[model samples]
Target: MDNFLETQLHPAEICVVCTEPFSLSHQPVALPCKHIFGHECIKKWLKSGQGNSSACPTCRYVVVEKRTPRVDFDTSSIWKALCDQPPERLNSLMMAIWPGLKILWQRHPSGNFSITEILDQAVIPALIKTARRTESPQDRSYDPVLDCYNLVAASWDSLGRPDTATGLAIAFVRLARLMSTASATLPKWLTSTARTNRLLWRANASLGIFELDVSWDFIIEATNLEEEQYFPLLHLYTVLVSQSIAHNSQPTPWPTRRHDIMNLVVERCCTKIGGTFWKGKPSNKFKDVLVAVYEELRRYQLEKGKMSLRGHDGEERVVKGIWALAGWTAKKVEVR
Candidate 1:
């Protein structure tokens, strides 16, 4: 009953097109606008009216589907050779092969690439094979796998493709899980749990819920304020809050209240920087840091309200929340 109530409180998953439940036969298909519908219904709708005028039934946004041809590459020898080698040799092989892969991807006829195919066919299998060779946790080296995944992620990001990056990050997480199960321990350098969580946070920044929550759990587990990693944690927290606000336009149900979230961040920042941060006279250094955070929060809020920036109550609330977090009054901090 509690589970049922929770489901009721949250948005229910249903196909908008056919007004039916999404199942295997009536699978949910996402349009460019991020709205989803029954696969068959969307296909029929696209075929209806002027075929060229096919648009998302929900948002009426024109849907342009880019199809790519599946290219089969014979990477059997490369995989076998890499699996048999040590981490050093594996790294050398990856460095040599990555350039060629990039060139091939660029020269592909379709231009539209699929990261899933690349990872599944080559990268993941190689990583698993290599992992299986190590008898003990200490003997296993994650550098090669981590380096390869990072390279792929960088390539996707450079190509202005977050979607592909997200897929690659997810693939890395799966690879890490596989390795952990095989070795019974995750590598220190890779920090598999925390790193994967961070990747998940990055990958789903646009529409993260479960990923964001899980990322936070790992982050808190991995670091405390006394460490240097605390700064990165702060940045991650800011990003998550900013993204959540922009995406939802209202208080997120998970966090419950926006002010509560900001207060927690503020408390942590104060503890890390110094006890004097929010006390007596605020130091220039502390103020400078707070200003930077405030500016970023303000920028994201404005971007979210780009359609109509005037008299936006939600934006005002966010602005006020940021100011309160820094122990400053609204009048003391000029938003404009």
Candidate 2:
């Protein structure tokens, strides 16, 4: 099974990361981020588990060649992996999570019940109970979302399930799909993130896990979020160009001709985006970067006679149903 850690079975293919097409001699590795690149090209990028280069070149998702076993059964990392895996790897994932998951798993599949059924029976009710506990007019924290997560983690621990974070995450994902889907009964409660979060938030006041509800507090936090700006347009542009020139040599040299070109292009585009930044709405900068990205890709094609836009993709999200305006932010609110 070619999991995230393994390379594909193809005899020959393009390493989209480096634009290097290698045959059987050197295969590109498929990353957990779902991007493929020459093993060494990606190796240099993820050579350190610390700092900027530690993440996937295109999407900035941190990629680790090897993971130390999580003694604490931490939820975040294990959650991301299990939320996406092949059916055959399910058993392995369960084992990796904890030895006790098998017990919980077996109780469900008496050859009739599905995994979802088991989660709904064993977990959702607990989630609902936890959510109810957190609802209050006086709770305060630097990050309310993190507080909610901590509470959820605590509640899961008391269940005596003796499971790992992976198990909890799997149960969480499975439980979410059963809720009224976004296009159906859930449009009123969910936004970009999942709706099942509030199952732990108490009695369907809002659905889904930490997904944004786009109300007042949500609007304020979104506006004030200090997270360094990320531009998919600039990200894709630089990633495509940078990996196209990565080499396996020790200290894998930076500042190659192509690398420098990528920097210049990104710098130029960012300047344009800054001028057009929507003053208050950081996300609106995407509109500016989109044009800059298209122009850059076009310019590359004109010079090289082959547009290097093969790595580009567009994603569309649907928010169906009448949305329920709910706000969950950790920002301290002034009662005024």
The numbered model that scores best in lDDT is 1
* Candidate 1, 131-244: lDDT as tens digits: 334543323443444444444546655767433434334434333222222111122233223333342223223222212112333333222333333333334334334433
Q: Which ten residues in a row have the lowest lDDT in candidate 1?
A: 178-187
**Residue 50 lDDT (model 1):** 49
Q: What is the per-residue lDDT of model 2 for residues 1-336, given as tens digits with 9 covering 90 to 100? A: 548337644453777556778766667777787777888877766654445566788787866434444354444443444334343333222222221223343663322333344343434443333322333222321232233345445655566543332334343433332221211222222322221232211211122233322122222232222311222222222323322322112123434463453444444433322222112332333323333333344444557655333222331010000011111111111121
lDDT of 2: 0.35
TM-scores for all candidates?
0.22, 0.20
